[model samples]
Target: MPNRTAVHSELYSPDSADNPSLNGGRCRSCGYVFFPPQRYGCESCGAPPEKLEAVQLGGRGTLHSYATVHLHMGRDIEAPFTIGLIVLDDGPAISSTLANRTDEGLAIGDRMKSVLVTASTDQAGNEMVELRFAKAEGSK
Candidate 1:
């Protein structure tokens, strides 16, 4: 059993605590892919709600954009993190935290891969895992 649970059941794939893939929705009608597994109709083409199908991303993406965080923003999360917008191989761009936060070491077009990381802890002290993008080895 996974120690972590996605807000929605279809949000993650291989549905395990270890190295689960991000489950995105692809619009069969308009080819729009979304990270939240689009249960709603496509806003672009007004495709019927059911047109969205769940697809497992390859877990690899190219860094399209990024922002370095400096404030905690009243959240439980820490500061000095990197938030990246990555274009996945499967055609959807998703936002995730980067394992490496330093701007000096990160660059646009760098290859990133999804990996399980701790989001926080539960009242029971169990870790909550979430997907994060990290610099792939040999990918500068």
Candidate 2:
């Protein structure tokens, strides 16, 4: 669970799991998709801000890029972990952590799915939700 203020406004709520996925803004004028969902105006075609709509993103994506993090800035999550960018199947690319790391065989361009996880905790001890990418089951 995450407090409204504790959650990233640009991201959807992890708990909802229904409508709560990354919200993207699509320009009705040019069909441009904006990740982090634009609030006021469109960066492309100068579309009016009112023309943008909130679009729920698909949880499936391809592992665009990744790296094993030996260190991190936050204490809530353990270090020596893996993080990467997932280019959603129908949305913009987002940076997220890999669900499980096994020396077995993780590679780039692997297909993955989004899973909700605890990103960190607030000073008041509220858990912050985040999206993590995991290799799709049966993927090798």
**Which number leads on TM-score?**
1
* TM-scores of the models, in the order given: 0.82, 0.75
lDDT of candidate 2 over 21-83, digit per residue (tens):
667778888888767776787788887899888887877778877888776789867877787
Q: lDDT per prediction? A: 0.75, 0.72
Q: Report the backbone clash tally of model 1.
A: 0
lDDT of 1 by residue, 86-137 (tens): 9988787888888776566888999888777667768876566666778877
How does residue 2 of candidate 2 score in lDDT? 47
- Whole-structure CA lDDT of model 2: 0.72
